[model samples]
Target: MPTRPSLDSIALMRQWLLLLVLAVIAGQVLRLIGMPAADFLGSMLVAIGLGVRGARIRVPALAFKFGQGCIGLLVARSLSAETLASIAHDWPVMLLATAITVVMSLLVALFLVRYGDLPGSAAAWGLSPGAASAMVALAEDHGADSRVVATMQYVRVVCVVLIGAVVSHALGSDVTPPQIPTGTAPLGFTVPANGILTILVLTGSVLIGARFPAGALLVPLLAGSAMQLGGVFIIDLPQWLLCLAYGALGCYVGLRFDRATFDFVVRRLPSMLFSALALIALCALSALFIANLLGKDFLSVYLATSPGGLDSMAIIALDTQADVGLVLAMQTMRLFGVVLIGPYLARQIIRLSR
Candidate 1:
C-alpha cells in the first residue's frame, strides 16, 4: 500500500509532521511517568491509534533499518571485557538462568498457540526475555506478525518495569532513574576520535547487514560488542540519536498496522495481558531460587533475570544500587541467546504443541 510515498517533498513533510508532533507529546508524558522505552512506546501507541483510525503515512524502509542498527549498538554498549569475565566466572548460574528463561518463554508461547490461536513465532519471540526492540526485529525477519510481536513484547516490558520498581522500592531504595550530567560526551569522557570511529562502525554494520536476515540489528550488536571487548573503542550513541532511532522504529511498526491486525490485537488483548503477567511471575520465582543458590543479593539477581528492555532494567538496577555489572551481563546473555535460538525454539514448540 504505497499508502507509502511519492516524489513531492512538501506533501511528504505534511504527512509526517502531524505524527511527529503527537509522538513528542505522548513520549514526554510517558517519560514523566517512568514508563519503559517511553519514546518507542509513545510513538508506537500513537501510530497504532492513527492506523486504526485510517492514517496513511509509513516510515521509509531505510530509516527503519538504521533505527534497528542503532538499537544493536545500544545493546552492544553493555558487553565489556569485565562483564564477560563476570559472566564466565558464574557460568553455571548464568546458564541456568538463561536456560530457565528460554524454556519458560517457549511454554508461554505454546500456551498462546494452543489456546489463544496466536502464531507460534510471534508468541515465542514476544515472550523471549531479551531486548524488546531486537526481538521484534528478529520476529519480523522470521515471518511473524511484527505488530503482534511488538504488542506482546511491550506488554511484558510494562509488567517487568512495574514489578521491578516495586521490588526495588520494597528493598529500601528509590526507583528513580540514575541521572547523567547534561552534555557529557558519550562513554563518560571526551573522545571525539573514538566517537567518529563508533559512527563508522555503526554505519558500516548497517550497510553490511541491510540485506541479511535481522542483520541490521545483529551485525552492529556483534561488531560493537567485539570492539568494546577488545578496548578498541566504546560505542558512543547520544541520547538524541537514540531517541530518533526509537521513534523511527516505533513509527515503522505502528504505521503498518491494518484494520484486521488492529481487530485481532483488540480481540486477543486479554490473552496477551495474561501471557505477559504469567511469564513475569514465573521468571521472578526462578530468580528467587537462583539468587539464594548463588548467594547474590535478591534485587540484583531479580533485575538481571527480569524480562524487560535493557534500558529500563538498567535504570532500576542503577537506582537500587544493585550489582549493575551482573545485571547487564545476565541481560546481555539472555538477549544474545534469544537472538540465536528463539526462532528455532519457536518452531520446535509449535511442533510439540501440535
Candidate 2:
C-alpha cells in the first residue's frame, strides 16, 4: 500500500504542472510569432518579473535541476571512439578557441567591474561561457549575490539564443512554430539494451555528483566519451529523453527572470548588451578564421564559434538539420576545455590588466 499525497503537497504539484504547461504554451506562442528564441527570453522575463514584484511563484527547483542532469546522460550516448578521435585531433584548435574566449570573457568582465561599476564576482560569473545554472551556482559559492548572478547569466543566455535565431532567420531559414519530436529513430536503427544500461549508469554517476553544479554536465560528458572510446559501452538514448532535456532546460531558463533582476538588468542594459554583442562578435571572428584555415563552411564554424550553452546549441543544430553530432561533440569538447582552463586565463588577464 502507498501513502496518499497530502493536500498541500498535491496543490504544490498541481501548481508546478501548471507552470510547466504554461511555459510550453508560451514558448510555442512565441515561436509562432516569429520570435522562437522568445521561449527562453520569456522565461527570464517571467522569473525577473516575479522577483521584482515579490510574486510567490513556486518554481520546481528540484525538477529543473534533475532535468539539467539528464542532458549530459542523453548526450553521452552519442559519444564514440571515432568522435573522440576526431575531437582529439582537433583538441589543440578547440583549446586555443577556449583560451581565447575565456580571455575575452575575463577582459570584458574586468571592464564591466571597473568601468561599469559591477561586482567582480557577478561580472566573472555573468560572462563565463558555460550554462547559466553553472555560472549562478559558482557565483553563489564564491559569495556573490545569487539574484544578480542569476540575472546576468540568464540575460546573456537569452541574448545568445535570440541572436542565434535572428542569424538563422536572416540567412533565409523559416521562422515557424517549433514542433516537439516524435519518438522515432532514423531508418534501420534500433536501440540496444546495453546502450540503455550505459546511459543509466552514466546518469546515476552524474546525479550522485550533481552537488558540484556543472559537474553533472561536465562529468558525464567526459566519462561517456571515455567509455565510448574504450568500447566499454555503446550509447543510444531515446529521442523522448532528448526532447525532455531540451524542454526542461528551456523552461528552467524561462522561469529564472523575476522582476527585481529585470530592473537591475534594465539599469545596466546598454553595457550588458554591448558586452554580449562584443563577445559574440569576437567569438564569431575567431571561428571564421579557424574555419577558413580548416576549409569548413561558415555556418558550421559559426555554430562552433557561438558561446551558447552546449545543450541549446545542440538543439538548434538538430532543428536546423545541421550536423548535430559534430555540433555536440565540438561544443562538449570546448565546454570542458574552457571550464578546466578558464580560471587560469582569467588570472592571466587580471595580471595583464593590473
Candidate 3:
C-alpha cells in the first residue's frame, strides 16, 4: 500500500507555491498600476514591516543575488561595436554630457553632506546615479553602511521612473513604442547553445575576478548582445523568471529596513529628496543640450539622460512608441560604461574635491 503524504508536508509545499505565485502576480499588478518601478521597493517595505514587528521572514540571499546578476547580464547584451562607433562619432557631446552628469551628482552629494547634515558616506551613496546594486556593493567595499546606500539608491530609482514617465507624457511625444528593430521574426521563445556558453564564460570571469556584481549585469548583457548582433540568437529571457528575480530583489531590499535604518532615512529624507530632484534636473538640462548638438529629438535625449533601469527605460520607450532601439542602445551603453568607469570617477571626484 502506498502511504499518503503528510498533511504538514503538503501544507508547507502549498505555502511555498503560493508565495511564488503571489510574487509573480504582484509584479504584474504593480506594472499595471503604473508604478512598476516600485515593484521591488514595495516588496521591501512589506518585508521591513514584518521584520520590525518581530516576524521571522527571511529572504533567500542567493535568489536575490542571482536576480541582480540577471539584470547585469541583460544590460550587457545591449552593447556593441556599432554603438561604440556612434558614441565615438558623437564623442564630444557624449563626453560632455557624461562629465556634467557626474559632476552634478557629486555636487548634490556634497550639498547633502555639508548642508543637509547627512554623513559623507550616506550622501555619496545617495547621489550615486542608477546602478543601485553596484553602488551598494561599492559602499560595503568602502566601509559604508549598505542599508543606507540601498535605501537611497532604490528611492532614486523610484523617483526617476515616475518622473521619466510623467515627463514623457507631458512632452506630447510619449505615444510611440520603442524604435529598435525587432529583427525579422516575431518575439518568441528561442534559446541558443552559444548564448548559454557565453553567459557561463562571462559570469565565470566576473566571479573569478571578485567582481560578481559587475559580472551578473555584464555577463548576460554581453552574451545576449553577441547572440543578437551575430544573428545567431535572440534575447528571450522568460518574463516569469524576470518577475521572480524582481520579487526576490524586492523582498531582500525590504527585509533590510529595520527601525534604526528607517529612523536614519527619515532624518535624512528631506536632503535625499532634494538631491534626487537636483540630479534629475541636471540630467534633463544636459539631455537638451545634447539633443541640440546631435540634431536628435528632445525625447531621445531625455531618456538617454534620465537615470533608471535599462529594462524599465526600454519598456518605457516601447510604451511611448519611441525609438526603442536607440533608447535601449544608449541605456545599455551608459550602464556598462558607468559600471566600468565608476571607480575611476569616484576617485576623481574625491581627489578634485579634496
The candidate with the higher TM-score, 1 or 3, is 1
Candidate 3 versus truth, CA RMSD in Å, comes to 7.7
For model 3, residues 148-225, the per-residue Cα lDDT tens digits are 778788667757766876776677653531122223322332345434544564456345423455455455555556
* Per-residue error (Å), model 3, residue 264: 1.3
Candidate 1 vs candidate 2, lDDT winner: 1
**How do all the candidates rank in terms of lDDT, highest first?**
1, 2, 3
Lowest lDDT 10-residue stretch of candidate 1? 177-186
Candidate that would win on lDDT: 1
The superposed Cα distance between candidate 3 and the true structure at residue 228, in angstroms, equals 2.7
Misplaced by over 4 Å in model 2 are 1-18, 27-55, 58-62, 172-199, 222-240, 341-354
TM-score of 3: 0.70
Candidate 1 lDDT over residue span 1-354, tens digit each: 456432233455665787899899998886776554567767877877776666667788788878878777766665557766766789789888989988888888888888887877778778877777678888888888887888787667757766776677677654343332223233443466567777899899999988765567768878988877666666677778777987897777677664666677679888987888888888889999999877888888988888886656765565566777787677767877887887788788767776
lDDT tens string, model 2, 1-354?
Answer: 985332233454554565556566766676675553445544445444333444445446655655555555545555555755766677677667667777778778878777776766667767888766766666676576778767776677777777776666566555432332222233322346554655576667667657775666666666765665565555555545554555656656765555556667789888887878888888888878877765666665666668788766655554454444566766766666656654564455445545
Give the lowest summed-lDDT range of ten residues in model 2. Answer: 180-189
